[model samples]
Target: MLIHGHEVPGAIDEETRCSHYHKENDRIAIKFHCCGKYYPCYKCHVEFGCGKKEVWPKAKFDEKAILCGSCGNELSVNQYFQSGYECPNCKAEFNPGCGLHRELYFET
Candidate 1:
């Protein structure tokens, strides 16, 4: 599904939530560094993305790699890291649990 003009291949709703991790605050899509495509989660990328997966390099942390589903705002990796698990643009909460999987999408 498309959310905020970005394709979240396994998204189950406009908020970017997917079957693997659907919660009230699960509302961000990640722009995978490997293929430059947005996916709702790592599992979604594994299932619907290009075969290769690569974490966003630390040097590229300034790149806009996170999409806030609430207001269609694209945030740089650094911005997202500093957002306190909320969308700075729209004040929408983000799943804090996602931090546990940080290494899956970013070079942590």
Candidate 2:
């Protein structure tokens, strides 16, 4: 397990495997559970850690940073240039560079 940026030697319960990635040539091959076959297609080069479940570039984005309320954690305009306004944080999901943060509260 990772503790304070260090890994402790112990047993783990979770594991993950990608039907993609080439270790010999240092490349990743794409594999989807559809059509019963692994196929190659378009992919995004976003920073590692973003969730991607869609097709191609539409799959990757700053999903984690979207919830960051701290300044300098905002999305960049260049990313906006590629894909339009689509905030993944609060319901104010259409203002790419909005200066306002959402005040919505949920207790129900």
Candidate 3:
């Protein structure tokens, strides 16, 4: 799918194959602020990410910083939160447990 005129990769189809937090049908891939790369969740970042995690600047939360791995929609952190953690485009349900790791992507 096209996001901001660029290609955003699709979600990992085999959820169990990866150590991320996505459930069997979750389509949201977190655009980790530290590396500016998308992953299924913080655990995926921890296992596959590069270097140490860097906090997202408070000012960047409004940018299209999160990704809908299903349809390649780039949404802001606020939009993601407002979405009830679901993808607005494809209506894919996100893992509810994701809330436990909010600090990985956003500042408390």
Candidate 4:
């Protein structure tokens, strides 16, 4: 997909996924994930490594994503960290229990 450079800023609600996806063997086969972003779209642990303040450092996030630090033990796409979207993840509010810590910040 050719994303116009001008369109980059207009992408208010867009997700960048593997252009080609298939399942082989016992693992969900996927092409080499091209580095782009890890913006958490939902409570599904989707995160963007944009280095935003919402991005959890390597050690903070964990495998067992139980309760998030912002939304408490809730399971909803809206509860997950997002970019630009008004963040509901607050201290002691929701806890995204996962191996990767989340922060709502962007590296400039």
Q: Which candidate number maximizes TM-score?
A: 1
Q: Least accurate stretch of 10 residues (summed lDDT) in model 3?
A: 8-17
Better of 3 and 4 by TM-score: 3
For this target, which candidate reaches the highest lDDT against the unseen true structure?
A: 1
Per residue, candidate 4 scores C-alpha lDDT tens digits across 1-108 of 112121121112222122221111111111111222222332212332232234333443332222221232322232333312222343332222321322322111
Per-residue alpha-carbon lDDT of candidate 2 for residues 2-108, written as tens digits (9 for 90 to 100): 32222212212111112232122211112221211122112221212123333323233322122111111233323433324443333223332222211111011
Better of 1 and 3 by TM-score: 1
Model 3: per-residue Cα lDDT over 1-108, one tens digit each = 334444334434532213444456555666777777766666677767765677566777787776665566778887888888777877867666777777777887
Q: Summarize candidate 1's per-residue lDDT along 1-108 as a digit string, tens digits.
A: 988888789999999999999999999999999999999999999999998879999999999999998999999999999999999989999999999999999997
Task: Report the candidate with higher TM-score, 2 versus 4.
Answer: 2
Off by over 4 Å in 2: 1-72, 88-91, 95-108
How does candidate 4 fare on TM-score?
0.16
What is the Å distance of residue 82 in model 4 from its true position? 28
- Candidates' RMSD to native: 0.6, 16.2, 3.9, 13.6
TM-score of every candidate relative to the true structure = 0.98, 0.17, 0.74, 0.16
Clashing pairs in 1: none
Off by over 4 Å in 1: none
Model 1, position 28, has a per-residue lDDT of: 95
